[model samples]
Target chain A: MSADQEQRTIRCLVAKVGLDGHDRGAHVISRAFRDAGFEVIYSGLHRAPEEIVQATVQEDVDVLGISILSGAHDTLVPEIIDGLEEYDAFEDTLILVGGIIPDDDEAELKELGVSEVFGPGASMEQMVEYVRENVPEKE
Target chain B: MSDLIDELLAGKHRALARVITKIEDRRSGHRDLVSQLHQHTGNADVIGVTGSPGSGKSTLVDKMAATYRDRGLTVGVIAIDPSSPFTGGAVLGDRIRMGSNIGDMDVFFRSMSARGSLGGLSTATTDAVKALDAFGKDKIIIETVGAGQNEIDIVKTADTVMVLVPPGSGDDVQMLKAGILEIGDIFVVNKADLDGANRTVQELREMLDYSDGAILQSSGHHGAGSMEGTDGLQIEAESEGWDPEIIETIAQRGEGVDEVLDTLDSHATYLDDSGERERQARTRYAEEIRTLVREDVNDLMAEELDHRGGMDAYLDDVVTRETDPYTVADELVGPLADCVRDRRKE
Candidate 1:
């Protein structure tokens, strides 16, 4: 979040990572995030490790939301977090992953430092509020 | 050389890149730039590449462009990356795969975001192609915007539309959505090095066997399987590269691109001899754009009527059974017309 948004609220970056090209869910959720008043930067489909990180840095976003349905979550998710950490966005940006997961990968994904994994039919309003409540209120 | 046009016409790579940015941003001066460049079009052969996600579209387009450049043809590529439906911005990552061609003087490749367009293209894509067209490229290849079947809109703009089916996908049969199938002039089964390459070809042949259109199947990965899908829709057995006319190769290796190019030229000639090419292009936007404009105007009227608690009140009245939606809409249209008339009176 920039100082302007942080003065009152939070800013978020939502991206589609890896080859998971299903974007309708990501797009709708990002719009929900935006309507919730969080400044949202959505990186369109097929983002590489470096590209997502560059967007996170440039946007100064407070939260990172990733939507992947390509079954490449295990490979792409960790690499993106690592890139965020390298870019110093890890501590500042809260990471969220949403997509069609088999339910078995949820625990491992969270253990690898993802904050939340909302699955299919997840509530967009709840996700918006979840981000709002989680990001610390700045002085 | 209206800055970008001058650069594009001069065959400058960066200028083409920057103009794509301007057009994507919907900047003010773009209309004039494209208007001037319009005269430069009709020279390049437009090829569209589209397929399922992770189908290696960017890599294939990169290799194809390089191959065209090698053939002493100036290449123009419009790589359509998907855009964030929420924020309306694109990742434009084809540059990662197309490393050298980014700045090649002879090859101009521009990566564009689909910009919330459901149809695998931006509103500016046709104009962008026109810009590249006017730049005098002999061949222009458009990579699909990673949106799968919806990206079929490329058929309206491209001279030869290549429907890429990656090997082992098992999803190739699903790509025959009404819009996409009719548009494909040639079919490329990319990633041929994979195990299910032959099976995929067989499945596609079987599916297209009874269909009316022409179909060709070639691998874009390793140079293998040149069998044309139109030959036998149902291949009982996979024979040697018997026809040699169909098997093309190695999008990753840029192998057999010459063959792909030759096929595209032949197909274009066929379309010309049959006279289906211009007939299609003329009515391309007429039917589609007519409905699109009506939709926009309907949406405009809706927004205009919703400004002052009008929608909420109408809904409340309808919910209360005091008024049907048709009556409310009728009541609203009169005021809406008056509002428009009053504005005109101003």
Candidate 2:
């Protein structure tokens, strides 16, 4: 990598929102991002939407991966987006949701500012490539 | 001053975060930014908390920050996790354990990756502390990447370095006898609710007693705590007279946190009374200057090597024994040495 490219390394945050105690998937994706040469920050399980958004802003991550398994994506994801909007971070941040996201709810989530949704069995490589290509350039 | 520094000094959390990111990434102008921040520092109490993984360093730091907030003292926390050496990437999960400061901008928690630094702290950690100090934080806590014996770098960054030992780890206590034991200002026996808590504390006390004289002498380098130089005979007494303190706590329950806070305050006072703070600052500034000069010279040498057609150009000659590695090094460094020598003669 060029010096400039190395300095501008992509930073990603893997977050678990709400009362989802299952974190094996979150851990898996966090490791995947790390192996992809992205600095990954994992917000452990049972985080509130506001808490996750707060961390996102503080970390200034290029990608925010919200891993939800509790089927509360409809309520929790929007609140997180709203929190990011409050800080004007929603636009600059590429938001990705993973884990048990239904096809019916995927469209609504993308409409609500989520960049993409990866259901079960979505290849980690595909998600990694998607983030590498889609992360927004910093000013 | 740049707008970012201006905003940071004006107490904007976003600016502080951006400043730290710039420092961590080593972006252009970060050196200049840190130079500007130097004048605004020395007000905050910098503390370092480090221990082995699962020793509850984060839990204790969270409680410490929350307690400081309750006392109306603004706080900043920098938690570090190691990066993957192979990939140059890291998964920093320290924020997960630091839930108390969430949504409270006053705490200003940031997670940093070690980024291939062998010392268990990112190279930018000192500069990040400067950013927080310039932002007017009252207490700045640095939580190091938890690699037990290699955390001596924490001494350079913090006034008080607390090493936490999980209860029932008799082996862990012995491990401290290597290097971590030398730099610790306060030894915390965390998870005091565990079965072997008392035994752990006893072991720590015994160990501290055994190392009493050695601690006073060797601690002069980094100013671990009190250990006032014994009269004029001992040159090592740059700090106040402080024997390391041992405290036990169940960090998960906030047990014994008040004592930790009190010990921190007492250490700070001791630093002031003994005039060790100024001495420590002088030593740190000297080290920082040396480090910057060394890094800059290294970069210059790399550029010079490239100008001389790089190392590959000399490879064939060295392989055939027509020229040796030392000769090549001397040839590369010769011009710089000549320049210095000529300047001295002039």
For B301-328, candidate 2 gives per-residue lDDT tens digits of 8889899898888998999989999999
Clashes of each: 8, 6
Query: Stretches of candidate 2 above 4 Å error?
Result: A1-6, A102-105, B117-122, B146-150, B171-177, B214-240, B344-346
**Which regions in candidate 1 have their CA more than 4 angstroms from the true location?**
A1-139, B1-15, B28-40, B86-90, B100-102, B117-122, B145-149, B171-180, B213-248, B287-292, B295-303, B306-313, B322-346
TM-score of chain B of 2: 0.88
Per-residue alpha-carbon lDDT of model 1 for B194-261, expressed as tens digits?
77877776666545543543354353432335543333222312432112123335578765566677
Q: Candidate 2: what lDDT?
A: 0.81
**Model 1, span A5-112: residue lDDT tens:** 111325566787777768998778766765565555566667776666655553445678888888888889898888767645577568898887677798899898
TM-score of chain B of each: 0.74, 0.88
Best by lDDT: 2
Stretch of 10 with least lDDT, candidate 2 chain B = B224-233
Chain A TM-score, each candidate:
0.88, 0.95
